[model samples]
Target: MIQAMYKRTKIGCEVLIQQAIDECPISTIKLYISRYYKKNNQRWALWARQHSPLLLQVTSTNSLESYHSELKRTTSSHYGLIGACHKVVALDQKQRTDSEYVAFEFRTKKISVMGLDDEILNEFHKFPYPIQRMLADEICAVENRIEKGKAIPGLTSLHCNCLFFIRYLLPCHHIFHEQIYGPTKLLTTNSWRNFQLMFEESGFEVYFHNELIEVDILEQTKAEKAAEN
Candidate 1:
């Protein structure tokens, strides 16, 4: 008889298993889901269950410091250190005060503000909530319209190229005009770009203004033709 010697050792490897539920116990919480299937020759009733994790697997190493640091990188180039600092201060002020408007302007040269007064009054009927709600809704609506290839109506200017401040801090227009502007020019493109670059370098994303182009329902232009093709 031959003698055998064995040594224990730890081993690990990632494995993907088929019909994964077989490896684990199902919870008693029975959920009903609707599924549709095509009809085939044989008449049969089938029951199948599947489990999908709702929350993604999160590794909790990243922190706020890392995030802010990333943002600082993008913004520093566009806005100098001082201008960037001012924007941060202005943003904080806006958040605290809760009165701010974004830079928006009419895309069409001939566009008239005929219904603007009524819209403004109707939307901001309440003392505090209306204005807030209007801003929130308008932002969402404009984003949606842009995504859906629809026209975004009405535009408001952001004093100067202070789009960075508006995008980041969401300050009220009154404070921006009174506090931020200087010597006729409120903010310049270079200043805004630098500030925006700093934010970008610091790991923040910039959302530029929406493109102003009307889609003709009746006429199919060359650009539209190429897209369809």
Candidate 2:
């Protein structure tokens, strides 16, 4: 079962079953295919799932350490579910306050522009400071990366197949290359259509002053104000 789970195609599963179990391999593989996979391609199969070989690059144990430690310190083992819920709400409020402070600082003290393309950098600056910082670092990585064989997922939109893009869902080196070298157009709110959006519609306000991104705040604010009410 363990080895069969790795098989992506029906044929692949049958071959594995044949190698392992000499009898009724065909029937066994047919049953396995029917039960194990949804569409036979979207399982824990090695090729289907996007993952990086570097463990630390994708996820880190230390990333949640601060939140875990704070939660642990605030909540006792003896607390009931309701008490624990209250502790979590308090902790969340504290973290949100800290985040708002950092965001305010980022807005007032604009981050240093690291990338060369003024067009993209202009868009990058509008996002929250944390997102701006993240994108700036990505641009630097792209600038230094040897682009001989960048794993471009597609050029239809700003998307890449690289581990970096897969992990962050941000513009990767390949997408940057498209804008810099290829015939790809400039960035805009509708840049990613039929794909994952980088930010919410409310976050689009950050692009207000950017000449390249033609976002209409006049129309947006009406709905935003209504939603808040």
- For lDDT, the strongest prediction is 2
Q: Write the per-residue lDDT of candidate 2 for residues 150-201, one digit (tens) a residue.
A: 5432387655656566545567666765656566653455663312233444
Clashing residue pairs in candidate 2 are: none
Candidate 1 lDDT, tens digit per residue, 31-80? 11011111210111111100111111111336546545645653566797
Best by TM-score: 2
Model 2 TM-score, 2 decimals? 0.43
Clash count of each predicted structure: 27, 0
- Give the lDDT of residue 7 in candidate 2: 50
The positional error of residue 164 in candidate 2, measured at the CA in angstroms, is 2.6
